[model samples]
Target: MAAYRVPHRPEVEARARRQTQIARWVGLALIWLLVGVLIFLGERAIPDQHLPWTPLSVVDPIGAATKAKAARTGEDVAACRGVLAKGGLTYVLAEDSANGFCSVRDAIQITGGMAPLLPADAAMTCKQALAVAIWERQIVQPAAFEAFGHAVVGIEHYGAYSCRRIYGQQAGPPSEHASANALDVAGFRLANGEVVWVKSDWDDPGLRGRFLRQVREGACRVFITTLSPDYNAAHADHLHLDMGGKPLCA
Candidate 1:
């Protein structure tokens, strides 16, 4: 009665240790399940355009997934045209042509959307047109209003489809223009009868300069390449925006 103690059992201690580890694993499993459910719900709550897996619609708001979705349109001509139609744009498919390294296929002439393109017949790839439409709606118009308190009435572009190499070089890689994959935006015409020329107003200390810079920055977000006056003398007279070749923003 004075000394009564139970001896420690190795088997019992081992069993207890195993049970603790099992409980820890079970808790971890529960935590992971809860986290997965939360992520699923979050994705469901977001818009389709914001979700990377959804089909792209040109009318969709510009979001993190917008650029990637737009880029994918280049892979399918029909899909790109479908996006344009769904966005309520007026466009006509241009006749397909091929000549040496200069070929234009799956290209379109956008007649109605935000503003008319000057020269009335500037044609570009469907993917390029889609990007232009989105840029005008999301970036250009908003920047125009913020800067000039007027809406853009027309877009003045140098050209879209040109059969020439980069800088018209006699020998080198072909330019985006060769396939109608690029747009040279020379300026914009505002509702107030005012014209903003990149060559003339690019350095203006007033609203014109601000508007141009803002649109250029937005173009960098939407297009794979955005070259402005700041890039080089070659692009000093227009903003060279394209969805071809390497990515660049200068």
Candidate 2:
């Protein structure tokens, strides 16, 4: 018998090539799966301490300057207008909270970004107005009008919105003040022509202590965080106000 011969057919060769291609595809899929698993494991192994949330860098020099300017001019404007009417001044009338700059201007216009409560007509929020009214009737007005015989002056405040974090807090949630949810006050003025500045009075044992006590007491009914001169050097110039969650004074 002649030796049996096995002949290669084109169809058979094509089928073999297709099988090879399928195997390669399978291998690639497995590799991808392995990579995905490894990545998941690596993420699980990292510690939260090594990947903490960090606050954004400073970028609002103009805002800072504006705040300073506002603090200086806010009181003067209020005096000129008398009783600090809200819907009167051009800046107050044109304030569009949608625009960040305009909000700051409004803050400066009404409260100096840190002064006592404004008149109800010039208030940004009910809490703010209430606080100011209370302070004026119980503290500012009494001290200036009846006690000291002053004009019972109004207050100035820092704007209500910012896109930044609390000072010295590099890793945490967004600041309440940054979202139009908070306020930073620079100081207050008495109608007796007395200006009790935060930066200046923050460290004075007598004036600073009294101011902090009064503000803190008032803030309990308004802001969440009533940071004052006692909180830190940064707060030495203003009383931080937040109308968010529960009251937190520190």
Candidate 3:
């Protein structure tokens, strides 16, 4: 007599598949949770202003995380575009990719935003441009009204995307500007038609000083890196903001 075998059950197989999927999702969640923890510990944005990053964890224990990040970055840029449209912001989209040294593709040339602020012509990654829009909307305008009783009507910037090594050094890593990932703001024009230069007003210890400090700190919520006159002599004349994902908020 031949040995009898149990037949496969379709319902049981379906249950097993469901369990497998649940387990896979749980594992992914755990992996991202660990990354989130590391990000929280590593990020040092201003108090109450730490940015919620785009889940850009570099560790890919499963080896597929990189692909997932690429997909997410695309989604992030799309979301930024939506925000720009809804806010009535004005900008021109840029081509993707600068070079191996510059990761910015899908950049933008921002021409307008809250209070008519504009960036010098340069390819600013969609993420960086959106971050600036958010900063202006949520932080700069409100702070100006509160601190100065006037709205910020204009802003001045050195530029964004200089393609140089950090601090113009012949050696060392490329600066954030190399990839169009940073902006250097030099000053602002207020509703009262007063110009506040970062160099002159940074030490005012008055409403102008407080307003500058507030915006600088507020930028930490959007830009992962915010360097001001307080950071170093190189940044003494401007507030340097970048999406380098560093925990820097100087």
Best by lDDT: 1
As a TM-score, model 2 comes out at: 0.45
Would you list the rank order by lDDT, best first? 1, 3, 2
**Tens digits of per-residue lDDT for model 3, 1-250:** 9999999899999999999999999999999999988777766442222233434321211122322332244348776676576667788877766665656677888777566544456568777776676677777888888987888887788988787888888888999898888889998888898988899999998888898999998776556789999989888899998777476789
* lDDT for 112 (candidate 1): 89
- Give per-model TM-scores: 0.84, 0.45, 0.67
Off by over 4 Å in 2: 1-130, 143-152, 168-172, 207-212
lDDT of 2 by residue, 1-250 (tens): 8998899699999999999999999999999999989767755774322222211111111121222222232334343233234322222332435443223333432434223344322334323332333343444444434433554354545655565555536666656554444556665566556766767765566744565466655554334456776767777677776554355677
Q: Write the per-residue lDDT of candidate 1 for residues 1-250, one digit (tens) a residue.
A: 5898798899999999999999999999999999999779977898876777788876676788787788887668888888888888889878999999999987899988768999879889988998999899889998999988999999999999999999999999999999999999999999999999999999999988999999999898789999999999999999999998688999
User: Cα lDDT for residue 155, model 1?
Assistant: 95
Badly placed stretches (over 4 Å) of model 3 are 1-75, 95-104, 118-122
- Candidate 1 or 3, higher TM-score? 1
Instruction: Estimate the Cα RMSD of every predicted model relative to the unseen true structure.
Output: 4.7, 17.1, 11.0
* Worst ten in a row by lDDT for model 1: 57-66
